[model samples]
Target chain A: MAKNYTKISIETSNDLKPKDETIDFLLNYSKALSVLKSAKVEFELVLN
Target chain B: MQEELITDATLVSSYIKGNESALEILIKRHKQKIYSFIYSKVYDKDVAEDIFQDTFIKVIRTLKKGNYNEEGKFLPWVMRISHNLVIDFFRKNNRLPKFDNSGEFSIFSVLSDTSLNAENSIIKEQVEYDVRRLVDELPEDQKEVLLMRIYNDMSFKEISDKTGVSINTALGRMRYALINLRKIIDKHNIVLTN
Candidate 1:
């Protein structure tokens, strides 16, 4: 009996680009997180 | 200097230091590779997109909390995160990805390498663009079949039905498209590898 082997190549084309909406959503989400983090820091400073 | 030329490590640190746009630069720079990796695993654009978002969100939380200690191996570290999330996706759905070993989902050894730095990514994008341009030089019929098969992920039957051609004809066109693409690549001396 002989074993068979197959090789597959991965395509690195631009066709797999994520939608712009996804990128915008991520930017906004990160911005909101930073805002909340700063707000928390300011509140902590006030408490101190 | 342009922000795009900044190293991923610099961008990561900048983002941690409250520079929001640094993260945007990082994301835009590497989004295609990350998204393509996830899509290769899940084969669903929407799910891959969601996983991409979640991966970045985890990155943000980890960086904000000062937990990201990968020591400048930004892309591989992010790839590892996305890989784990893909595994988690399968685990949640009570399924397993292909190429599992002893009930552990592990593949894509290429993702562990640090070869995909900023320069390499830019070169890869250029190669992709060049390949697409060469594809456009193909005959209209062959290019149509090739795009349908590759980009659209359509089966030969589907392509034939869509293009009102027989399955054999569609397959022939796909084969010729590849042959001609190789010739075009050779003629242009374009190396299509990252």
Candidate 2:
């Protein structure tokens, strides 16, 4: 029996930034969506 | 029942038995993280909200059908559902962001390219693993601010208020987090692509 393996090559870049508009968008969207989801669940439960 | 003390599996079982409050408790417990994971990919409030709702609805439907298997790991299951929904949202919209040669930043570009060759898939997986490991290795304060900002979708002001720090301090922590992550990637020679 032989085991299969995957080979990975690393190419590093210095351009990726931590803080960006995308990050902001994701964070804010998550916060708002989470609140909405919880409310929706509660509402659905009430109707059931 | 003390909802706080109840395990996720127990809450899920209760919900399956028509205990609505159990479902509510489950939602409240994992909502923030699940929502954040979805928004990280979709990055739209309304769409993320829609998908978030749909994810839970699907969860309820599946649970009712006795389909969900990861009883104790409910949050991870929900997160996976939200992630697939986000992908479906992109596919339906036909607006999957691609890597631009001009280098405009979009989180989608970092995810993966449309090409699905085995080699490229392996490389993408490795890159993702490396990046995740680097993030996990970040200092606690830096990682906290980073996750709150990126995963939890919090503003610097909100983070500052929540953590009892000045907004500047919160911003600085995020900045340092990025810089440190960049340094780690450079040191480890990890390559990221779309």
Best by lDDT: 1
Segments of candidate 1 deviating more than 4 angstroms: A1-10, A35-48, B70-72, B97-194
- lDDT (Cα, tens digit) per residue for candidate 1, span B8-101: 9998989888998999899989998999899899988889989999999888777877778956599999999999999999999876546655
Clash pairs detected, candidate 2 = A11-B191, A27-B153
Interface RMSD of 1: 1.9
Candidate 1 clash pair list:
none
lDDT tens digits, residue span A13-32, model 2: 22212223433443333233
Candidate 2 per-residue C-alpha lDDT over B116-164 given as tens digits, one digit per residue, 9 for 90 to 100: 7998889889887877788899999999999899989999989999999
- Candidate with the greatest TM-score versus the true structure: 1
TM-score of each: 0.50, 0.41
* Candidate 1, A1-48: lDDT as tens digits: 997685343454667878999899888877776323463462211110
